[model samples]
Target: MAEKTTSTVPKGQKSQFAVPYYEISYDKFFQFGVSVDCVVFGYHENRLKILLIKRGAAPFMGMWALPGDLVYPNENIDVAAQRILRDLTGIDNLFMEQTKVYGQVDRHPAGRVITTGYYSLIDIAKHDPHASAWADGVYWMDLNEVPKLAFDHSDILKDALQILQQRVRHQPVGFELLPEKFALADLQALYEAILNESYDKANFRKRILSMNLLISLKENQKDVPHRPARLYKFDKQRYDELIAKGFSFEL
Candidate 1:
């Protein structure tokens, strides 16, 4: 015999077949958000430094972390990184490069956010220290003394450092952290700082000068007791022309 199921309703209740109060869809299952993190590196006093900010918001409030924020819905990731840097450091025209994307499911506490990390090199003395509202409390910490950072920032920094080391060897990126005019020794020292090792001075100079990328300036280092070294400036016009002609700046 076939069993019959009966629907029941109370006297004061609405009908069982009334309109549904809610709806669900399978199409909304795989949504995620995006964000940008800036690994800001600064060179000063012969030490490599990174910019860190004390969080003023929740999910890591009061904790030291890399400067970052959620990306606006209509903005691109690189633009978001630049915006975050401008807001946090009041500095612009930075040499920024995309490093990596962090997408661990639990990487963020508030929700599932995939953050694209970008690294920038800035001359500490050239930038305005009071640009960001949070800049007052922000600080430049020695790279060796980086504290426990929020999220996987430590890993991000490690990767960025490796990229920086490689970039320094084959590119003219060190000039970005230096003054407009620099001595060969200063340029070599900057390279050594990034490489974390001593390089042969003669060989270094030979390689750097052989590229014919610098414009020798008539000025010399001043205010020093020892013999002054001649100053030189990077020739961007020549560099661009060489680069356009398939010239590689390899060490």
Candidate 2:
């Protein structure tokens, strides 16, 4: 039998090889840039504080912005958020959750960029002061007295705050911001801080204690000049069990 040769060209084409019709230049290809912005919320000194950093580069130089940066080419969104948080705030393993995506074309002054905002709750005492000082500017601003932020950060903070308020009503996220062994008063104060309003102490205690989510430490508050209040800790195991049984905490 004779050997058969197959043409490498498409049907009806005269040439055995096809020539490239159009070329795509690397520079002309659309680039989809991504970034992660963290809305770090912490409750300290009876006030809610948010982490912010001063812009060190152009487009918003010297202006206050949320602690964030471009997502590294080799990093995932969540990892990028964690890395940014650690770099900006010096805190790790904090309670962080993805909140929303902001894709306004003009959100970034330097270029078109899409951002994923993450809300994190952390105990202020756990932050490392030295690491936080590495940024061009790092400060914990009182949530109530926040100044105008660079870019769309103000909007992002507002959205995160609203979500935090809603989550506190039904979830136990507040525990992450408060001290490990806290008092009923501490819990009430945390709620008040987030809601920006005061609540009746007696009523707040009655409601929260009724849920049985707190574990009495059988110890009193330490280092206070006045009479020490009873200390308590959140019962995660019990909370989880209750939540699994369709229990919800609503204040």
| lDDT tens digits by residue: candidate 1, 1-251 | 33444445556667536633323343433367888888988888667889888877777777888888888988987788888877876766676899999998789988889999899777778765443655335788889899999888889999999987776655565556778888898888887777787778888889889988898999999997889999999888876656456444344
The runs of at least 3 residues in candidate 2 whose Cα sits more than 4 Å from the true structure, single-residue gaps closed, are 1-29, 129-134, 222-227, 242-251
lDDT of 2: 0.78
Q: Tell me the spans in candidate 1 whose CA falls farther than 4 Å from its real position.
A: 1-30, 93-95, 131-136, 241-251
Q: Please provide, for model 2 over 1-251, each residue's C-alpha lDDT reduced to its tens digit, 9 standing for 90 to 100.
A: 43444334555655423552333345433476799899988778788898888877776878888888889888988988888878776777766898899998779877788999999766677675322533577788788888999889999999999997777666655555767898888788777887787888788888888888889998999898888999998898977766566444444
Q: Give the true-structure RMSD of model 1.
A: 11.0
What do the candidate models score in CA lDDT, each in turn?
Answer: 0.78, 0.78
Clashes of 1: 0
Report the error of model 1 at residue 194, Å: 1.7
In model 2, residue pairs whose N, Cα or C atoms come closer than 3 Å (at least 3 residues apart or on different chains), thus clashing, are: none
TM-score quality measure for candidate 2: 0.79
